[model samples]
Target chain A: MKLILLLFLGQVAPVEVRAFDTPYDAGGSITIIWEMDTAWVAKVSRIGIFRASAPGLQDSLIETLYKPDSVYVDNSAKDNVPYYYRIVVYSDDTLIAEGKTASAAVSTQQWFNGKRLSVLIILIIYTVFLLYFIMRARTNKNLYIRKIAGLEAIDEAVGRSTEMGRPIVYIMGLGYISDIPTVASLAILKRVAYKAAEYNAEVVVPCYDPIVMVAAQETVKEGFVEAGRPDLYKESDIYYLTSDQFGYAAGVDGIMMRQKPGAVFLQGYFYAESLILAETGHSIGAIQISGTTAVTQLPFFIASTDYTLIGEEMYAASAYLSRDALSLGTIKGEDYIKMILVVVILIGALMESAGIRILTDFFSIF
Target chain B: MTTIIWTWVAAFFTLAILSFLYKDNPLYKFAEHVYVGSSAAFTVLYVWVFDAYPKLVIGFKEKAGMQKYMLVIPLLLSLFIILRFIRPLSWLSRWSIAFTVGMAAGLGITGLTQGFLVPQVQASFLPLFVRGETVGQTVLLTMNNVIIVFGTIFTILYFYFSREHKGVLGVSSKVGVTILMLTFGASFGYTIMARISLLIGRIYFLLHNWLRLV
Candidate 1:
């Protein structure tokens, strides 16, 4: 049908149409290019574009475009379906020339986005360093991480709670079970729980997430089990209250107010509620040690809490607390990687100043 | 027809929650419970209405080729995660979690590198001094860039873990701590401003919207 229409309109005038698949895209796009014949320039006032899917029974008029608008991208093309495009010339609402794609075209998926090669390159660079460090870590178990003060204070805090004869309140902030900082918080929770068990101090953990509650229960149980105080581990101690941020904060604040717990462990992913929890713990005269990966909430924790694992130091804190060689090695590796990044940045800047485009351009995203 | 009644319901819940400022009580509990329960229900509703129906079901139906059929991958993965409900089959959920954690790590690397690292490095290449400009503007821009350049380097150095904090490196790390403290103060001020703004909105609602005393 498209052939017949084009042939019928060919006698009027021939307007050549070019259609090809768009490149460097994920899929589902085609570009159409056409030129208005110089001879037909005076004869035609405007032009139209139409596209039809396979088994073309009809044409869907896409646009009625004017002069100097000869290019269009048919991003509306579907994945599997072949698309045929046409250019129609209208001289005062009369069909003057019609040009259609000789063959049907389908958009194909590209293996890679060449435009984002720089991203892939940098990713490879980071991966190489990570792998190298991991390999080196297998050998270098002697690697040392600087002493994180917050972690060292964990024992002191737990001991203080034991001495005061008050329960230790450990609140895991409202983060999903899968959040990295939350996982790290749970590790530290285990450490604190073990210390509490050893000291025969009751450890009260109020969880925001039910999943985290179950996890924390298991963790604290393990801590007591490891401490050879299985009899002291009570399932009722670690309980789920509510997941709502404010509600959890209020619940924690209530615990802090009523018990005036000797030591409060505020750790994990907290948002606006960081200040609330820390401030409440402070008001209760509890020795608070807080850590969060949330950059925005750190200052509140710093201002209110006694010891803070600043930023990424929370991850290092877990390894530091555990005193695991593998974890220490990984932290050391990460430090080395940071140095590499620093060097790269400095070199890139110098190159930029020197008008040496090679280094800077190679790292350019676009 | 229900607009006035709806307003009353909202206002009641608002007051119930606000009452917590005095102390936790039954009203506060009622409001908090309602918030949690409704939020959970809304989450289910959203997954069904927006996500499950539109993205999964409709997409499966509308999708024509390999890409459309590939939707089964995530579907199967989700079903595996649902196995956690069955205690004996709970170990199967680990596969799903592994997939999620793996994808998150992969995507996080991409996001952190492109969204943060690259743009940050690119943005830091500001000129040390402005050429062919008035001294005031030149001095201001130069100083701004200078602080940014030094602060960025120093802050990163402060977080540097491998080296012992002694000598020249120690001095820079100290400077980094100072910069970080200044940044924390700025962050606190900004955050407090936002919180105060929210408080102002709540106060306005109590005065005009609910109490109608304005």
Candidate 2:
């Protein structure tokens, strides 16, 4: 039994270690190689690499390698700084063996260093413009903004549904409650529910995720409560159908067919099911307003829906719905930065076309 | 003759699908049903050949060496998934639901930590400046590396929740959020531009390739 225990320990031991020159990129990196013992082949766990400034100093754990591989490259060392490296091997819960330290000093690479100059200039310019806008917006400067037609039409959509004596259907697309896009969707939900409560119209929300269904229920309840019509909120209206993407689409299609809602609102992230849902709403002669950041689904929505909020417009919906100052400020800052970008692009293009290298050079000094 | 036949078939299917944009008619409905049926059949065949046969059945036979009995569990589980047909037995599908949810949660947590958190933290911790041979290098760090490292640190702090953002960190994080928003907006604009370009390309194709127009 003692001999068998010894054999097991030996079989699980860390493999031989060798230091090799780091290749391809630069001399700043060092590569270490090892061999895994056969007995722990499938079960052998991650390798950990530790680095130290000096031989006698305590080594700081630099990185953990999860792959069951025999090689690791330490790329964190700086130029002219003497460094020591070590590796720890593991099998399941057992630390099988640890390798000895290897020392090296990182050397500089000129070509790689020079290639990054243009990138630095671009970043600096972007950062400056971003800071400028943030400061300007903070001071509460008057900013001209165009009205978003979809946001302006929200009241009209809800009012029409109330007048027609038909329900307003709110479909939260296949996005998790935690995602920023879904948060925006919920914000819109609150607004729609509030309008529905005031107008005394039925609001129906069918969800794809259980968590989102719960959040939607809470948001709608809050909206009704805030509108002083808490009695009008129905829990059954906010319900989960299925997590399956297409299955939820089919269910919503059936709901649209049966109920014939006067207004349909599609918000949050959607995929292939977007067109099917939008087309179904269109067929029913409902006023369809859709918003999503999913670029692929945007075209289909635009072609089929009455109004479609394109990309960042969806992000701006929460602000438009709530009139939140922070969100409005962010949007204004975004516009300013966009203007700066247009100027830079035009200048860069003109300089390149005119063969004036100095303009490009001067621009690079950001 | 072969080219002509293939062109006609392609045109028919294209017209059928495109007709849905105008209104849902019988031709569009037929095309839609055909598409759905073909997709479902393809999915079943794919899962059986790629996922089920190899990963579950053959995997159990090779790795666990419990072939016949293990296969029984999966076969029953699959049948349970189809239990939606019966009203009473539908609740039996909870076993598969629980198993899938538990496994997915475990895998998602592992992937989130590995793919996002750890790498991002490590990437952010890289040194701002490295010694170079020239004075330009000493004056400024590598541009791409600087932006990546800077972006990572500020973005992380932008999501920090320990204290109210009021001081230097708050101001910096506010700036960071602005940068992030602008980048997102710019990327969105570029993406729309690319899509519009593609739409133009498709229109060009239809006019030039299908109709033989210049």
Candidate 3:
């Protein structure tokens, strides 16, 4: 089998490299093209574009383009400096062939200069505002924040689960642990674990990754210890259920049906399985509070879960949970930025409608 | 004949993904394991053949003149990763974790400044006036620009948290929240459309590309 695989790969022709015109009128970009051999093309999966300053430069790999096409455009290159590009063909992650270097020189154009300037100014103003608020918050000055009703309901959810003598099931979505939303999800889990510990309610966490399972177990253990219920902590409470997406979903669904937890906390990044889990939890009469940055899944959660935290709210879970002054201050700063955005949008709209160029011209100053 | 076989493979994958609607089964399990194993194996093989072997190994041989020594770093790293199976020496994996985290943080900070903060903020600013434009057109452009700028600013303000919300600042913050919520709603709508589009595209491919139904 291995010999056959090697011979098949050897028969595949190397990628062909050529320079071609980029799609857009933008002159600074150039496309690199290659051809796939017949056998390889039939089974070919994706092409990877490796870019560098010159050929044989090991440390200069700048980017990888993942696409099935034999061509890719280097759109972000600057004029005057030459760029060397290489292409690699892969089938299911196995490298089938490599292409030679194609060099391209970029030149700037005159079009879109006006639009670009306006964009630059607006970006500067908003950035300045963000930095100002961040500094203000950092200085520990008093910042007013509105109450989040969902946050207030956290205690109620835990207490209900406790009173009902049912477990509190917390499931982090399939988002990578490194993502901000996933971190925020873990922060919420920390709070939930603490509350559950205080209520003496069992907490079950079925994770999709071994790494996440480890982090969650540690966080839950710390939460229980802090709540003076360390004795209730069990390793099995936070267990690795397969890393497969739908498999994990199935395992979680089974747990929801059998354990029949009182409160189900769904936090983190979720995809299609979100609705399935929430609907199941809803059927079992569990009070479900869900938070995710996956906008596509938000509607499903909103329809099924009792309470939902939208977009940035998930990122603010730490602030809401800990009420840490710094985090809260950041939230307040974000609010100020939002307000400025609204006013600018309204004024821009009005000025455009009234045939007054001054408002827009003034805004262009940034 | 080959096309038919490929079509069958694709159809099988599509059905395997859709099978979750009914429940998990052996077919789904097989598909899932195949995806995971193939993806991981493919990643390793690609890195070896394309990245590691070409750039690091062969390039070093041609240019650096110390191919044998240069191969040591990656070899050791790969070895250490495999040692994760050993219970006691697992802590050695921290080196990889630290390296990954450090690189990610560095890249993130640089990207956040150039890709996000700079361009987004710059795009927000549009002069209140432009020369040689009609009054109505100018007004319309200005209003749109203002909304964009205002939205960007207040949204950032709404995230601030050093002080208490008691007075005029409180009102501004509330407005910020409203703008942010609207943005969220729009984003949510767009995302739903995007995912639905992907689903449609997949179904279209299954029908047209595979089954020839279309």
Candidate 4:
């Protein structure tokens, strides 16, 4: 019937239109796709989408899109309801040809996005690796982990401060508490605080975020408590500075100049002020140990600091320092996954070179 | 006259900050204190105007039904965080912290996986050779693809920590380090250029806008 109507309208090209529930979506949406020749596309000024509640019902023009759009998603469609759609081709605001779907499109909600199947698979495999090792860690205590110089130097940095009779300053950069790097920095700070408390030395932590300030205070207090020196923990040492980037840098530079800390730990996320802070620490004659995931700032830290934790090394600091069986196991699992990914990439590249798309097709979904 | 006065003030502050390059002086300290103090005040006002006022006060006024009532949860959470100053009620603040950490960790993992991990893996699937129209073009394309594919593989291998870097793994990781160092070198040069551009902007402001020497 749709074909007959198109023929009656003197349309030469066979009008094909489909309206269906969009896949890999949260639902209440129908996707309309139509085919048009490149030649016909030149004559089309706009395309109109018409929707009706039922077949043979008067459909209202829902949306008119510019030419070159072969697809349209109607997000306002009701779930589990059938929607009849018609595609009208217009030339200079005049309707030229139209196509209607032979069957209705129904929108329904999906529990899981099909497009994220690969991500789910990877997550499940990685989780399995973690869980297996975490459990196995109870028995297997001989996991061989490589040495990270930045983490290894923490004790030495703290000891240097103790010997010099100067406070150790730990800058948590400008990351809010929610950032992964900031959270990772908290773990490293706890270790530093513990060492400082053991040496009866002061550890000053100037925070960029208020919430991080509180967390740092608690972490320091915990470290002191663990060292059996809770009395040494000073709340004033872990304090909030301005959240403004340059303001924080200026404030920290001031602290470094006045206090003249023997050692400085620059950890977590940093921006333009990374060099300013590092350079200030250098001028103060402090031993600086820096770690961050910021690719751009790593060079500044590497250039100025005595030891630098590059990229993933910062994330692995806690696991490396603690040397807890479980943490080691997790690292082992991560390393294995990295190895697997390398293999996957190699095989993918080889296959792609040979004009095979098995792996490519599998991971092609956005 | 007002513009001139403000420009003079700005120039003085800028000069004061720059003087720190020579040594930390009283002028630098004075300028730094003013910057930090004003920044703190500005941050408080910014949060109230943009965050708390809009999300809470206006939400209570404008939002209807369930949404309006739901705002109470966030209000209570905010109070819990502020309750830390009371000492005795500091423990309550941990609840808010815990909620934020858990939510952030969960969101961070899923967000990174979807946005970074999958996209990166897909992008890395480059063909090792290309069939361009010319031999030179083909060779260039193939070389580029090989560099990308192997560069990515080796760099990833470098990050593996469970095993010691020795033998073949050591060589691969070494190559990775070399590549990473090269990248950092380029980044350093690029960032230095940006910093110089900023300095030029400040100098331009001093000369063109303030001093009017240009």
Which candidate has the top score in lDDT? 4
Higher-DockQ candidate among 2 and 4?
4
lDDT of 4 by residue, A247-347 (tens): 99999999999999999999999999999999999999999999999999999999999999998898888788777877777787888888888999999
At residue A364, give the lDDT of candidate 2: 36
| DockQ by candidate, in order | 0.33, 0.02, 0.10, 0.78
Tens digits of per-residue lDDT for model 1, A283-307: 7788999999888999999999999
Off by over 4 Å in 3: A1-146, A241-259, A270-284, A293-304, A310-312, A323-366, B1-103, B129-135, B163-167, B194-214
* Backbone clash numbers for all candidates listed: 0, 1, 106, 0
Interface RMSD, candidates in the order listed: 2.8, 13.9, 6.4, 1.1
Error of 3 at A33 (Å): 27
**Model 2 clashing-pair count:** 1
Model 1: iRMSD? 2.8
B69-166 per-residue lDDT for model 3 (tens digits): 76767656556655666969765655554454456555654455456544454455455444437888877876776676666656565554435555
Worst 10 residues of 4 chain B by lDDT: B114-123
Runs of candidate 2 exceeding 4 Å displacement = A1-103, A106-144, A348-366, B1-214
Best by TM-score: 4
Query: Candidate 2: which docking quality band?
Result: incorrect
TM-score of chain B of each: 0.90, 0.69, 0.77, 0.97
What DockQ does predicted model 3 obtain? 0.10
- Tell me the TM-score of each prediction against the true structure: 0.77, 0.46, 0.57, 0.95
| 3 versus 4: better lDDT goes to | 4
CA deviation > 4 Å runs, candidate 4: A1-13, A93-96, B61-69
- Write candidate 1's Cα lDDT for B1-214 as tens digits: 4866776687898788778667667887777677766665665686689888988999998998998988998888778767756879866766666676567656777887878777777677655555437878777877887788778888888887777778988999999999988989999999999999988887787678767898
